[model samples]
Target: MNSSTHLDLAFTALADPTRRAILARLSEGEATVAELARPFSISQPAVSRHLKILEQAGLITTAVDAQRRPRRLEAQGLAELSGWIERLRESWGYNFRRLDQLLAETAPALEPERTGS
Candidate 1:
């Protein structure tokens, strides 16, 4: 998928609080659907649904170990998101710097406020 597509998936997957919590849980280590569902009062099936969305977004991946499927965070997905955000931050920083320079250049021309006697 293209960068925009990937970003769209990632953002969509991140839109849910439950999915974000699932990701947080996986950050510590891999977990089964049941384990992931422990924090929330939701059922395992619901957790699995959230997991499915996360998997589609490439934010998480599942590993098969016998009967159990454990899910873990996929670093690359987050890295892609972070990289995109960083680029925007850099662009904004450049714009802010130019604005600062313009203000500095025009500072002297602005008259100082006079105190009312």
Candidate 2:
């Protein structure tokens, strides 16, 4: 997939709590579709649909082995997401620091006006 579509798919997949939980579970080890469905109340097909989204996002991969298709976490997509989030956080943090400094500098000037009033 192209980079933009890949990111859109990854974010959309992550937007669902159920899918996120599935990813967390997959992180421990690979699991069959049935095993993944066991923790939730949803039907097997529903879980499969969620798995499809995760797979499309490049967050997980399903491998066929005998009669079972095992799902496992694919860390690269998640790592890319984490890096993007961290960069956003850092940018916001720097802006807040600058704002704090500006407010501190203005505080002394405001104090004189308050006292005069």
- Top-scoring candidate (lDDT): 1
Error of 2 at 72 (Å): 1.0
Per-residue CA lDDT of model 1 for 15-105, tens digit only, reads 9999999998888999999899998988989988999999999899999999999999999999999999999999999999999999999
Candidate 2 error regions (>4 Å): 113-117
Tens digits of per-residue lDDT for model 2, 2-103: 877988999999999999999999989999989999999999999999999999899999889999899999888888888878999999999999999999
lDDT of 2: 0.92
lDDT of candidate 2 at residue 36, scale 0 to 100: 94
lDDT of 1 at 4: 97
> What TM-score does prediction 2 earn?
0.86
